[model samples]
Target: MNTRTRAAIIGGIITSLVIAVFAISLNSNIFRQSNTQQNSIQNNVGITSKLKVVASFFPLYEFARNVGGGKAEVYSFLPIGNEPHSWEPSIQEIEQLKGTQLFIYNGAGMESYISKFMSSGEFSNMTFVKVTKGITLLKADAAEDDKEILAQGGMDPHVWNDPILAEQEVTNIKNAMKNVDPTNAQYYEDNANAYITKLNTLDNDIKTGLSHCKKDTFVSFHNAFNYFSNRYGVHDVWITGIAPEADVPPQDIQRVIQIAKDKDVKVIFSEDLVDPRLANTLADEVGAQVLVLSPLEGINQTEQQEEKTYLDKWYQNLHNLRMALECQ
Candidate 1:
C-alpha cells in the first residue's frame, strides 16, 4: 500500500474508536441519572414521614413514640438510662435541636436546663409539649410529719409512674403531634387511643392484683414513686428523698430497718445505675431481699437493646412491688 493510503486508514480507525468511546461514556452517565431519579421517586412514594422529635428523657420519648408511630423519628436528648437531672447537653446536641421539629419534656421541674431554650424561643418553630399538664397532683404526704421535709413542698413530678397520669402524658403527646402535623391528626389520635387502652388495662390489673395485699406500704431507695403510690392505693417509705442521691443518713436507714421489721416488708427496692450498697446493707440489717424497681427515667444500654420501654419497666416495677408487698 502507498504511505498516504496507510496514514488515511489509521486516521479513519482512530476517529471511529474515539466516537465509540464517547457514545459509551454518555450512555453510562444517562443510566446513572435514571437510577438516581428512580431512587428519589421511590423514597417520595414511601409513607408520609412525620417531623423529628427530641424528648428530654424516657417518659417523654415513650409518649412521643406512641403518638408518632412509625411516622416520626423520636430520640432522647440524654442517652437511655442516664440520669437527666445532672446531664448537660453538649453543643453538638444543641445543634441537633436545630433540626428537631418538636421537643417534649416532663416540664414540672424536670429539664430545668432546657428552661432557657423554652423561654427564649430559639425553638420557636419546634412545638414544645409538657406532658404533665392537667393531671391532678399529690402533695408529699411523707413530709407532712417531718416539718423539715415539709418546708420543701414542690409537688412530686414523677407522675408517669401512675397509669392514669401516664395516659394524660399520652394525650399531651397526641395533642402536640396533632399541632405539629394537623394533616395526620387521626393517626396520632388512633395511636393515643391504642396506648390509652393498654394503660387502662394496666390500671385495672394493678388494682386487682393489689386488692388483697397484706400491707399497703413498701420501701424504696428513692422517693420517685409517690405518684404511683397515690394512684395505686399503696404507700412507700422512701429511704432517700427526691434527689436519688439523698444519702440515707444512718438514722434514716435505721428508721427504714425498723419499719420493714415491723411491717414484715421482705423486699427493699433499689434502681438500676445507682450503687445498691446502701439498699443491700439495709436488706441485710432487716433480713430482707433487694430487688430492682426501675423508675423508667432512663433505660440502660442493655434495656434499650431488649426493646424495653416505659411500659415494660413500669410493669416490671409493678411485679416487683407485688412480690415485695406480698400482694395476692
Candidate 2:
C-alpha cells in the first residue's frame, strides 16, 4: 500500500469514532430528559386524581376518612375545639371550597351558614352532602335570643350523638364518596361497613348500659344530647338552650336546679369545648359534682393529640353516663 492511501484510511476511522461517541452522548441526554418529564407529569396527575373531600366537622371528617382511606384527601374544615352551632367559615375556607370535589356537612341546623355557603353560587363543580338529609330532625329548644336559628332550620342537628344515627351519617358519607369516586366504591363500602360495625357495638353498649340506671334523667349544660337521650330514653335536661354560648335566664337556672335536685342527680354534666362555669355554678348551687359529657361537635387539642376516634370518645361518654345515672 502507498503512504497517502494509509493516511486517508486512518483519518477516516478516527472521524467515524468521533461521530459515534457524540451520537451516544446526545441519545443519553434525551433519554434522561424524557424520563424526568414523564415522572413529573405522573406525579402531578396522581395528586390531581385523588378526590378533595371537605367535611364540615370531625365526625363527618372521620366517616369520609374511613371510606376514602388512601384514595382521597379528607379535611375537617372546623378547627379543633370550636362549636359548630355558631361557627361561620372564614374567607380562606370559602376559597378552599372552590377546589373541593366533595363537601360533607351535618345538616338539620348544625351549620347555619351551610345553606348560605352552598347558595353562594360559587364553585358549581363541588358537590355538597348533608348527613342529616333523610333523617328526621328534632326541634332544638333554642335560647330566646337564638330562636331565629331554629326558625331557619327547625331541627336539632346533633344526630351523631346517637350511634344508630351516626351509622346512618357514616353511610351517607360513604355513599357521597362513592358517588364522587365510583371507581373506588367497593373500597369505600368495605371501610364504611367496618365503621358501621363499631357504631353498632356502641349502640348496643349504650342501650344495655343505660337501661338499668337508677335514674333516667341527667342535666347537661347544653341541649346537644337530645338525640342520644331519644335513643336510650335517658332524659337530658339542659340549663341553657341549643346554643352553647347563649346564657340561660335566671328563672331557667333555678328551674334546672330544682329539676336536678328533684331527680336526685349526683352529677352535673358539661361539654368539652364549652366553658364549665355555668355547670360548675349549678353544681355548686345544687351541691352536686360536675362531669364532662362530650358533645363531639369538634375535637380539642388533648383529644386530637391522642388521635381518638369518635367511637373511642363515645365509650368514655358511656362510662360517664353509667356513673352519673347510677347504672348497674
Candidate 3:
C-alpha cells in the first residue's frame, strides 16, 4: 500500500472510464446513421415499386386506375378539359412516357399521333395496350358535307361509350397490367373483376332504361355514340362528324332540323366540353330543349377535383336521355 502505487491504480481506473464513454458514444452515432440510411432506402423502394401507367385519356385513365388499384400509379396523357380527338402530346410529355411501364389507348385511330409514336420505336421498353383491340369499330357517320374533314373509311373510336365494350377495354387493361407485373396478377385480376361487375350492371340498367323510351332516335352534337346507339338499338343524329370541332354545314343543319321536327324530338344534345351555341340554335329551331351528353373524353378540373367517375357520368347521361325521350 505505497502512495505511488495507489496513485497509479487511480489514474488507470479514470483512463478506463474515458475509453468506455467514447466507445458508447461512437456506437450510438453509428446506429442512428444506419437507421437513417435504411429508412431512406425503404422510401425509395416504395416509390419505385409501384407500376407507372400512362393512359391516353380520361376513360382509359379511370379503367387503368381501377384495374391497377394500389399496385400502380396511373397518369392521363390528355390534360383535363382537352378533347382527345385532336390532342397531341408535347415533346416533354412524350419524353415523360419513357419512364412509364405501360401506355393504354383506344386504338381504332382514336389517337392520330399514336401511330407515329409507335413507329418511332422510342418506347421500346414500354408496353402499349390498345383497349379497343377486340371490339369491332363502326364506320364513322360523318355528315355528307363534312366527309372530307374526317378521314375516308374512318372507324368510330368511341367504343368506351358502350358498357359492354368498356368491359372488354377493362379486361384488356388488366391483361396488360398482368403481363407487365405478373407478381401482382391476382391483385389486378380482382380489381378488374370488381369494375367489370359494375359495368355489367350498368349495361343492364342502360338496356332496361332505354327499352321503354318513346323515341329511339336522338340528336347529338357529334357522332360519338355509334357504339352506344348500336348496342342499345337506338340511333344518333349527330350534327358533326367524328371530330366535334368540325363546322356544321347549313344544309346539314337544315336537314337535322327537318329530322328533329319529323321525329318530334323533345331535346337536342350537346357535349360538356363543346361550344353549345349551335346546339342551342338547333334546339330553338326545333322547339326542343338542350341537354349535355358527355363523350367522357376528358372531364374538367372541377369534376376531377370532385372525383367524378365514368359510371357517375354515364348514369347522369342516362337520366338526361330518359328525361328527353319521355321514358317510362
Candidate 4:
C-alpha cells in the first residue's frame, strides 16, 4: 500500500476510538442525572404526603387515631402502657415536633411537658388541640387537703371517665380533624357523631347500673374519679387527693376508715399504676374488699394483647365502679 494511504487509515481509526469514548461518557452522565432526578421527586412526594401528629398520651392518641382515620400518621409522646404524668419524652421525640402538623393534648392541667414545648417553639407550625377544652370541670373539695396535695390543688384531669365529658372530647377531636383536613370534614363529623352516640349509650347504661347502688359512696386509693362521682351523683371517698401519691395525711386515713365502717363499704378501688399497698392496708383495716379500678392512663400488656379500645376500658371502669359501690 502507498505511504499516504496508510497514514489516512491510521488517523481514521484514532478518530473512531475518540468518538466511541465520548459517546460512552455522555450516556453515563445522562443516566446518573436521570436517577438523581427520580430520587429528588420521590423525596419531595414523601415529605408532602406524610401527615405528622403527636398526641400527649393514650386518651389523646386514641382520639387522634379515631379522627385521623388512616389519613394521617399519629404518634404519642408518652409510650404505650406508661403513665403520662411520669413519662418523659426523649430528645428524638422532641425533635419530631419540629415539623408536626397536628398536636393533640389533654390540656386541662395535664401534660407537664407542654410548657417546655411551647417555650421552645417546636410546635410553632402545628395546630394544637386541647381535647378537654369544653368540659365542665370539678375541683376537689376543700376537705381534700394534705399540705403537699393542697400546694398543687386544681380541677380533676380525669374527665374521660365520665361518658358525657368523653362525648365533648370526641367533638373536639372531630373539630381538629376537620380543621386539618377540610376535604374530609363530612367523614370526620360522621365518625364523631357515631362515637358520641356510643358514649351516650354508655352513659345511660352506667346511670342505670349505679341507680341501684346500696350506698352512693365509693372509696379509691387514687383520686381519679372526682369527675365520675359528680357526674353520676355518686360520692367518692378518695383516699388520696387530686395528685396521685401527693401525701395521704393521717386524718384522711382515719376519716376514710371511719366512713368505711359506718357505710359498710364493700370494696376499696385501687389502680395498677400506683402501689396498691395503701388501698390494701385501708381495706384490711376496714374489712373492705380491694378492687382494681384502672385509671385508664395507659394500656397494659394484657390489655394490648386483647386489643382493648378506649370504649372497652371505659365500660370496664363502669362495671368496676358499679361493683365497688355494691350496686344491687
lDDT per residue, candidate 2, 170-267, as tens digits?
88888987877777788889999998998898889888888887899999878888889888888989987877888678999999999999999889
The better candidate by TM-score, 1 or 2, is 2
Candidate 1 per-residue lDDT, tens place, 170-287, comes to 9988998777677778888999999999999989988888888878888987888888787778888988876565545688778888999999888999888678898898899889
Kindly report which residue stretches of model 4 are placed more than 4 angstroms away from their true locations once superposed.
Answer: 1-50, 142-153
lDDT of 4 by residue, 1-328 (tens): 9999999999999999999999999898974665464345334433456456778877777777776675667777786667665466888777556556678887655676675677774344567788878776777463244332233345567887777888888788888767766766787788778778888898898888888877888887767787888788988877877656568879989999999889889898888677889999999999878888877787877777888877888788778877877787
Which regions of candidate 1 fall more than 4 Å away from where they truly are? 1-49, 140-153
Better of 3 and 4 by TM-score: 3
User: How many collisions per candidate?
Assistant: 2, 0, 0, 0
Q: How far is candidate 3 from the true structure (C-alpha RMSD, Å)?
A: 11.0
C-alpha lDDT (0 to 100) for residue 325 of candidate 4? 77
- Model 3 score (lDDT): 0.86
User: Candidate 3 at 141: error in angstroms?
Assistant: 2.0
TM-score of 4: 0.79
**Whose lDDT is greatest here?**
3
Q: List the residue pairs that clash in candidate 1.
A: 81-298, 81-299
Model 3 misplaced regions, further than 4 Å: 1-48, 143-153
The TM-score of predicted model 1 comes to: 0.80
What clash pairs does model 2 have?
Answer: none
